[model samples]
Target: MDGLAGIVREAGRAGDRVGYFAALYRQVTVEVRTAVHGGLFDDGARMDRFDTHFGNRYFDAYDAWRRDQSGPRCWREAFGLLDDPDTIIVQHLILGVNAHINLDLAIAAARTSPGEAIHALRRDFLLINDILARVVVTMQDSVDALSPFMSLLDRVGARTDERILDFSVRQSREEAWYNAVLLAGQNEEEREATIQRLDIRAAVLARLIARPGSLVRPALELIRSTENDDVPAVINHLDNAMERSSAKQGTA
Candidate 1:
């Protein structure tokens, strides 16, 4: 988790938008680690391995993308948007979430518990959704601070926009679970094919997030127009907010 924090810090210092996701991800990892230490999971040891494997997926992809090497299509889509001026902070975040959850999460779960053992992982897997929910709420608060118009857009959109975002997360996680089951049952060759397909599907979702429908696009643009453009400051603010949120969660 410290390694992840370093990545976030470096990206923030560079004013890289990639740090947007990295900052939020580091917080989620912190929460997961805290849960592991508290013995919140059914198998703390397995979760340790699971979290490590899951994080490596993002780390490896980030490294590969930095080197201009080939990686999963989904991650490429997310990383490719780093310099895009039109995308808002939330778009960067959800793009990362789309790739990580929809593609990497399933593969990590399957690798952690192959075949029949995947069923046992289900309980712990569902538990992560709860963790994600909490972290996302905190993340939203941080983003709201940076993008004040976000709250106004939420109201003007009747919160339907927020609901749509929530629904996407829930649906993707459910699909990831089913995909993990399938991957666990497959042989090496078959698993590769399935993962390739998942990557394509996830990349498509990233595109949707980058370019939403007309109804939401105007509001998103308005929010983006009013957002703080200081990349480093935005990243640091998010990181600090998440740190405070994690501390509160730890105490609670």
Candidate 2:
């Protein structure tokens, strides 16, 4: 937790609005770092660069959005909800996941290759989905400790019988890679056009995360009542979940 994780922890301790997403992102960066160190890709250096670029988009948008500057539309919507006392922690986490994976990841992937060769990164691109999947699943449990009401989501997700909540994040990552390949094949103008369209779609998704309609919103509202306003504690839960996931991976 010395790099991104530590930075996120410090921010949370200071009640910075960006801390929750930063913690989630820290887990993702850690997973990529571990994957790179273990020689898990065709080009570790390239993966590192891609990962850095991907994470930096979120960081840059967080800064710009916080400062009321022009930024990615999805992130503008996502980060805009950070100041509301009614927004639950899980909503914040999901908003970050939606904006980062849905928008930033595609842009990063396309820029990493800048041509049809974006397809060459597919194997490792999907590997990132795996890492993100694991972190989110672990957080499903970790979040319960931070807020006792989060299990309401699990129950609601179950009753929905669609698995969309559980499935959307991974599905979004896959779509991100596909969109990246599409963007990679385009010229500058077409690429920007594609990104603008994707940004609109992603911003719509971010709104859903914040106000996800009748079936789930009531549960979320109830969950917000017992708010664990201790931002640092929530960040620690995320870090601990990452450590536990790594330990389990080591044993396995």
Candidate 3:
């Protein structure tokens, strides 16, 4: 968690757009760690291992991307957009989420619980959705601060807009779970093939997130126009908001 936070801080200091996702990811890790400490999972030890494996995928990819080395196609798609001035902050975050959740998560789960043992991980795995929902709600508030017009876009688009903007975390995670089950049942050779397919699918999703569609693009552009363009300041604000949210959650 400290290492993840360090990455977020360093990215922020360097005015890197990657910090947008890293900040949100650090918050998710913090919440997952807190849940583990609170005995939220059926097997805390196993959950710890699962969390570590899941996070390492992102950490490894981030390290590789920074070095201009090849990585998962989905992650490469996300990282490639970091320098695009036209791409809004929300797009950056969603690109990261699409890659991480759609591809890395399934692989991590399969690695954590191979074979029939994957069934045992179902309950705890579902619990992560709850944690994500909570963290994302709070993170949305932080994003709202960064882009006040987001609310206007939300009201204008309603459910259709939300589906486009939010990218349906619940649905994505559920699909990831199904993919994990499939991967768990496969041998190494088969699993690699499945992973390649998933990577392509996830990369496609990243492109959709980055480009969305005509219906939402104009509204997104409006929001982007109004957003705080200071990359480091935006990252710091998001990081601090997550910290404050964690403190409140701790007290509660």
Candidate 3: pairs in clash: none
RMSD of 3: 2.1
- Compared with the true structure, the alpha-carbon lDDT of candidate 1 equals 0.86
lDDT per residue for candidate 3 within 99-179, as digits (tens), equals 889998888889999999999999999887677667777877788788878866556665332466647777889999999
Query: Residue 87, candidate 1: how far off, in angstroms?
Result: 0.4
lDDT of 1 by residue, 1-252 (tens): 887889888988789898899988888898898999999999999999989989999999998998885699989989998999999998888889889999999999999999999999999999977887677778887887898788776657655434534337778889999999999999999999999999999988788777778777777778889999999999998887767776787999
TM-score of 3: 0.93
Q: For model 1, how many clashes?
A: 0
The whole-model C-alpha lDDT of candidate 3 against the native structure comes to: 0.85
- Candidate 3 wrongly placed segments (more than 4 Å): 155-162, 246-252
| Cα TM-score of candidate 2 | 0.89
Residue 164 displacement in candidate 3 (angstroms): 3.2
* Total colliding residue pairs, candidate 2: 0
Q: Give the higher-lDDT candidate: 2 or 3.
A: 3
Q: Report the poorest 10 consecutive residues by lDDT, candidate 2.
A: 158-167
Local distance difference test scores for all models:
0.86, 0.78, 0.85
Best by lDDT: 1
Ranking of candidates on lDDT, top first: 1, 3, 2
